[model samples]
Target: MVEIIDVDAENVDKYGFFCMRSKPNSDGYQKKLNWVKERLKEGLKIKIIQENGRQKGFIEYIPGEFTWRAINAKEYMVIHCFWIVGKGQGRGFGSQLLNGCIDEAKQLGLSGVALVTSEQGWLPNKKFFERKGFKMVDKIDEFELMALSFNENSKPQFYDWNESAKEYKEGITVFKSDQCPYIQDAVRNIIEASKDLSISVQIVDMDSYDVAQKKSPTPFGVFTVIYNGEIITYHPETKNRFIKMINKKNLLTNS
Candidate 1:
């Protein structure tokens, strides 16, 4: 008896219930949810499942920028969040919600759909996606990235790294900030592993605008996986874009 419906302002509480179950009590979980709800801008797709007239579960999806690196720019779809209430499970509500997402992808004319899944241990069951024809598209350490492609011909795009120090040899150009531990670590790994490669990672102090304006500082450091001027992505869920100017080899990324 599960029925999926669109997300509305008044019934967000239902969606909140599902999200809390997915992530549980954290420092600023509630605040973050409220903020996202209030400030959601474009390309947000949401649905709620009601079983026998009772709220059972919900789902929220968006572009791949927030979830995985966007390997394909022609089109992208992402599942930002999903959950089923305690009492709603074991009653087949999960299948209904996933089906809704599939139908939604088709309706939106999307090339594919992707999501970051913590659907393991106490989170959503890992098999939840398998039942819906999704496959483990990629992985970055522990982050489980899954995707469901509607198109028959889907191949992920890869990035080529730059390895020329002719631009800045003495400035000690570090590619990351401590703010983003992943980027920081990638920088560390490259600098540390430079003994094995031709590139050296160094910390450079520059204005935020300089970082923004310059192409070398685009990959913000958190989820972006870059090394030696090449992009390393196991997750296509988030948007991983590297824009370089000609043969200069200064790479930039955002998302």
Candidate 2:
């Protein structure tokens, strides 16, 4: 039987939300756990799918105002992460988890459910959300802001990137947070890459939703790598890829 477990302070320690079954004792896990703990009081909801005592998938969402993204989340629930791994993919688990969020939004009398999606990296592709009746509300760069609205008058919006991106003027600047378990490793990789390339990279650790919403270089929020005032990407990659991206950018800049 498939069971959905809501992660709370009571059972958070018992289950891994993102980096499931691996790196339990790692700093990333602890950081993300602590982040989750704090957000719970602000209305973050995380639901995990389990079958035969094994975790199969999970989804995390929060009130728009408290969402890490730069959006004006006044009357909606913004999904931070949604995933169903391994054998969980082709089954009905994804729908189950998504429907759970939709149902909760209705209960809370939220205007709708919203999320930022992309064709690449951390966020999910737009297809699934579109299939579930989410419409493309806005777009910033490659990220698509999608929402499923119950109220015809409610229109969700993406945070202002034009002003936010201007916050970092030059060099390699990384705006990051502990919201995801893997971000620690991603930051480490970026640091290592910076050192190898002899580049000075500034790390801006986003400790709260306010900081992220106000300072994120990209509208998608989470983790972003900015090179010379322009956002390279919103997701982290390997050291080699980072180097290549930087080198390519340098080439274009010098050309």
Candidate 3:
């Protein structure tokens, strides 16, 4: 039988968060661990599925008010990350992990469970939630805000971004947080690439979940690259790809 383990301060150091197991000693790991520690005090919850002493999956969540996504999720439970890897896929582990979140939301007396999904990127697909009875409440760009509401009258909403993107008028701006272990390296790569291409770059490290929810130019709210006040991508790309994107944007602007 696979066992689900809730990560806490006592055991967090012993197990990886299911993404950065290889680089446990890296700066990204330390940063993400610290971030998780802080969020725990604010009601963050993480559960890992262990099968035969190996971690196969994990889910991260928090009270809706502390979710990193730019949405009005107050009185709801927000899922931040959910993943089932390798042999864990297609074995009902996904449903188990999701159900764990749903059960917790019910216990907390929240309005419901909410999560952000995308057709691409690091987020989960919408089909999984839809199959579990989540409804599409809102959408921004390519992202969808889905919710399983216990209250029929309550409708959560996505944050306004049209004006937020305008905050940075020029230059390549990266809005990021330590929520993901990979973002530290991605941020470094962008900085190096900017130097090579002689482009001005701004890196905004969202130190708190509130900052991310309020200031992120994109709804994904974890890592977003904005070029000349327009979003380029929400996920990290190779250094070469980053350079090419900047060059292409420059060409179009200069043309």
Candidate 4:
């Protein structure tokens, strides 16, 4: 039998946030764990799927006003992450979880549901959400802003990423938030790569939704790497990849 469980601050210790299950003791996991605790009070919701008795997949969503993404979705429910691992694919689990989110939006009288999709990184694809009735309202390079509106007149849109990028016009800046447990390692990798190049690095802590919505260099607001004010990456990569990306972009201190 399949089961869906709701995870809250009270039961989070029991159910976990789902991404860092294998490294609960790591800094990334601990950061995410604490972040989840604080976000729960701000109306974040997570649901996990279980097949028979084993955990298989999970989804996380939050009120648009408090979403970490660089989108204006004040009255919508913004989906942050969705994943189905291993044997969970090829089944109806994905649909089950998505429909539940939609249903909850209706129940709460939200304007609609919104999410950011991309062809790169760990985000869900636009095809799946498009098939489920989400419309592509905006586009920025490889990323797409999608929304399913309950009211036609009200919809969500992404912020001006180019304008936001102007704020970090010099040096290497790495922006990170506890929303994703994996970002801790990415930040570390960037620092290490910068060290190899003899370049100084500035790490920005996106500790609140306001900072993210206003200053995030990409649609994926949680993690970003800005090199001389241009966005080089919206997700994490290895130290070598960072080195190569910077070298290709510009001749820094050493490269």
Candidate 5:
């Protein structure tokens, strides 16, 4: 039996978000819980999919005007996360969740439902959105902005991230938000890795949607690592991975 439940601020504690379900006490989970609470007021929605009384997956989205991604999608609904894992795969649960979100967007008179997809890991892949009739409207690096528009001419596009990158031309800078449950660990590892290399690092928190839309160097928006003015990674990496990445770029000299 497949069932979908709507999670709101009032019941989010009772029905935890899909990620970190086993580690609710972790900093990442608690931070995400608080973040979700604030985003709920901005028209964010989370729906969980269950199969035979077990949680299988969840989908999270918000009105585009309030989105944390680097996009100008004021009249659209932007999906932040979508996952169907374990036994939920190949069972049409993903489509079910997407269709529900689409229906809600249509009901709200939004232009479309937008999503950021990638060929890399973390975000969903573009093929899934393509199968559901979404089209790529913009591309930056490995990330693609896709949308299924109700009005043919209306589409979402990414911001001019080049200008944003120019602002962090020196040293290692990490931009992060609480939108993802795993970013806390990633940021912590980044700090530790930089310390080991005897490098100075700056941490910028995307405390508001305005800051995120204007300054996030990539569509992922939640976590980004910039080394010497260029975006290195859009998602989190382990301490060792960070060390190797910096070394590979020759950003630091081996004394």
Candidate 6:
């Protein structure tokens, strides 16, 4: 059974499913746990599934401040991030988590919920949002935009994100590759951590790095935060430091 718990970031040292693979005391592993805990404080809403009283799987949802036009800003829940761990697989646990999200949204009086997912091959589509009754409302390049509007009237109205809103002063641009799940998870965590910040996230496919660099001159790294089109941080695969980078970036831009 999946039970929603009000967990503090500190308890993950023992209860965090994310750190089970490696000894938590190891320096690098401890860093990862700290990162998860920090991000959790930034709008991270978590739920865990227990099988025979052991955590078989868990999901995390980060709610952010950005408003989606789903049934107006008055009634919409934007799912900034959600994840189900590897141990939590093959038991229909994912679907249960999704249902829980729906029920939670309904309880909150949200007209609907909106999220972004890969179009099949980009990520495991089946495990993403397919069975949750989410439908493709639009597609931009390889990324697919989806929504599950509880109230039919709550459909999302989107427009071309203002690519020209304002040029970032200057920073590093870290191009993220899909091959690294840890990097992806880091990105997810930071995005969640950035819930109330005045920042923008652009998902780029590293496959087009050379082309993107030629298209625009900037430092290219993976799973990183950018400030004015410059790379602020780069890691081969680590979830920590992203939020700190993002917080710093936002300050620079908003200043």
**Which one is best on TM-score?**
3
Q: Between which residue pairs do clashes occur in model 2?
A: none
Which whole-number lDDT from 0 to 100 does residue 24 have in model 3? Answer: 88
Against the true structure, what is each candidate's TM-score? 0.50, 0.95, 0.97, 0.95, 0.96, 0.52
| lDDT per model vs. reference | 0.47, 0.86, 0.88, 0.90, 0.90, 0.50
Candidate structures ordered by TM-score, highest first: 3, 5, 4, 2, 6, 1
By the TM-score metric, which is better: model 3 or model 6?
A: 3
Candidate 4 lDDT trough over 10 residues, lowest sum: 161-170
Cα lDDT, model 5, residue 112: 96
Q: Total backbone clashes of model 1?
A: 16
Residue 222, candidate 6: alpha-carbon lDDT: 23
lDDT of 1 by residue, 29-136 (tens): 454455445425545556778867776777766554432222332354666556787888777777777777777767878777765455332223447787777777
Per-residue lDDT value at 17 in model 4:
80
Record all residue pairs in model 4 with backbone atoms less than 3 Å apart, i.e. clashing.
none
Error of 4 at 61 (Å): 0.4
The true-structure Cα RMSD of candidate 2 reads: 1.4
Error of 3 at 187 (Å): 0.5
* lDDT measured at residue 123 in model 1 versus the true structure, 0 to 100: 27
Model 2: lDDT of residue 196: 94
Model 6 lDDT, residue 237, Cα: 28
**Which of 2 and 4 is the better model by lDDT?**
4
Clash number for every model?
16, 0, 0, 0, 0, 9
Q: What is the alpha-carbon RMSD of candidate 3 to the true structure?
A: 1.1
User: Please, what's the RMSD in Å of model 1?
Assistant: 11.5
Clashes of 2: 0
